[model samples]
Target: MHLSIIAGSSGLVGNNILNQLCEDNHNVIAINRKPISGLHPKTTELVIDFESFLIDGSLPACNHAFICLGTTMKIAGNKNNFRRVDFDYSLDIAKKAFESGAKKLTLISSGGADSSSKNFYLRVKGELEDAIINIGFESVNIFRPGFLTGAGGRKRATSEKIFMKLAKFLDLILIGSARKYRSINAEVLARKMVSTLKSKPGVNYYYYDDFIK
Candidate 1:
């Protein structure tokens, strides 16, 4: 019975989150770069050019904001462009949502994220987490699941599909502490996000156990 803002609705995790949000009866404002169709009845879709003044005062007052936008260095063309999407764009949207009265924030971050890591990708993820944590939201949920499965169509490559299927199957044997390293279904994480809309104040990190459960 709350309004939520969801950016990156075209992504595997975000799309699933959108579906679960609607099923839970929460009104959603879904932001996408391109036009889309066939979403749930509770969703209001906005095709936006991120920085243009289009969304300036148009976004509704929301209870929570979920940011699922991210891209690999290869897909983004370089580290700079990758930062533009993962860091710049994400932080911008978070600020906007907070300004519009969203008190809770949910972000889809990768596992092994470290601000000082030698790995560039994980470093960016860590930096984004750092930026949003201090953005004045009452609650922030960070999901750092490893090897996100069920991204079959999003990957759109034969080898990638095979890898994801293998990862999904391997989830059976990943037990105990090793469970944190297990591949998790995007839909499971999405449901977890929707279920935690009213988490306690401050930051919460969900690994395989908390999110996949």
Candidate 2:
């Protein structure tokens, strides 16, 4: 299938998806803020600022879109900036993809995403999920993986690094409630997202345990 991906290209998940899509001979359009080195033959790269990228007939006709865009507080250095990457940028791409005739969208969201959650990060994720659903795609898939595993680009903040390490151990102990804590290999998550599109559609939401299994 022809695909367009946003965000996470520099991150573990995005990079894995890009590689796998190219390997499978799927036509891919990768959008990023900076140039991505070593893309595959089937891949086309676009470097542009997400906030100001105007849709002036550059996007290809696509069947599916994957939104892997995200940022942390440390990377963004501010809550508002973080939200811009995590929420606003994602929404922008989704809207443009829909406008360009893409019928399916898959979003990489966190496990605790809840529109009514008290936690800021999860709440923002939930709000984005809700907003995307309201945008009315023909098919939507929301993947909520746990602590992602695999290496790419730069490491996250020290605290996040420590948490991911600790979570790996705890994942073995907690089974269900902490299922979201289970660490998922980035490649596995990407494969699952792409494979799901082949099935009959509705809004399919996969939690961490569901993804790992």
Candidate 3:
């Protein structure tokens, strides 16, 4: 069984990934800002300030590190705070995991990520991808699913819900090269991320087709 460390254990995609990891009976170290309950018996959770942890905390040895940490500009209140969560905190955890001897790394990125993109959000995602790739893990998996859904009970704006419903219809029409832009469920993407950890060395990017497959 793998001993893995997962950051962002409280988000939609991250929470699902955590569940999958625990259900497989793998040993998990879940890091979050606050404590969470109802986790599997195999999971251990840590609550701490990310910036402080990065400066002083060290991780135990792990085979894989999964980073699902991210924040939106709106919720973050500004771009700097958004980057601190999405880029700074995420990169710091990856560094700690590497120092702890993790061979594989899995990250939850987004569709349309490009470092040189004019879009700020996509640019940050792309920059994070490049930074993580340079960490020299034995294997790296980056999932870029668009329009993620399937985290139940969270309040969403009505327009957002409508767009999600629309994604189902669009999924059918987004064929061929466009299939990568199709919407994917958070749980589906999490399962794919967990199953592919043993992939061959080198960086791998997964889109909607990759997750659904």
Candidate 4:
């Protein structure tokens, strides 16, 4: 039996991936701080304090794990809090998952993510990507989507909404290499991630163009 574990199952992309996995009849373990509303035969909800996840003794062995947990500085309230979620919590979970026998791990990252970036958010994401890669999963697929559009009751700041709207409108005009910078829907991203499970053992990177494909 192939089991899949998803962190941040309550978020937009995570929720979509959880539902997609269930629909594919894959057994899934959903990890979240709070309960996610959904009922599926192959779904197991694991609610826990992310900070103490190392000692939780509840992690189930899985074939693959998806890291979807993320937050912004505004919502996290401070730079320290933001780094805790985006960097500390994610890397810790990745390490724990790696030790749990998950052969493949997929990360939902962002475009322009660079550990040496001047932007705080991008730098944090880049750092997490680097750390996870070093964990040495048999297969590590990093998806760097530009802007995401989807419905999951996820709250977005005014500026974010404006940017999303602009990206959505501009998506139609983006072609060829330009598509790599276009906005992609959350559901689409989830579907692609699941579909790519058969990928060979190695680290792979996907950008906006890859998302459209």
> For each predicted model, how many residue pairs clash, with residues at least 3 apart or on different chains?
0, 0, 0, 1
Candidate 3, residues 1-213, lDDT tens digits: the string is 579888988888888888988888889998899888787889888787888987898888889999999877777999899999999999999999999999999999989999999999999999999999999998999988788888642367787789888989988988888888888888888999998667888998888777877
Top model by TM-score, which number?
3
Using lDDT as the measure, which candidate wins? 3
The positional error of residue 153 in candidate 1, measured at the CA in angstroms, is: 6.1
lDDT of 1 by residue, 1-213 (tens): 589999898888999999888888889999888876788889999888876733453567888999999877668899999998999889888988898899999999988898898999999999999999989999999999888777522555576678787996787788877788788788888899887697999899989889855
Candidate 4, clashing residue pairs? 180-209
Q: What ranges in model 2 sit over 4 Å off? A: 54-58
lDDT-wise, the better of 2 and 3 is: 3
Per-residue lDDT for 1-213 in model 4, tens only? 998898888888998998899988999998888886655878998888877775564467888889999987779999899999988878887888888899999999998899999999999999999999999899999999988887873688789888877887888888877777788899989898886567678999998767767
Model with the higher lDDT, candidate 1 or 3: 3
Query: How close to the true structure is residue 183 of candidate 4, measured as C-alpha lDDT?
Result: 87
Query: What ranges in model 4 sit over 4 Å off?
Result: 54-58, 172-178
Candidate number that wins on TM-score, 3 or 4: 3
lDDT of 1: 0.85
lDDT of each: 0.85, 0.80, 0.88, 0.86
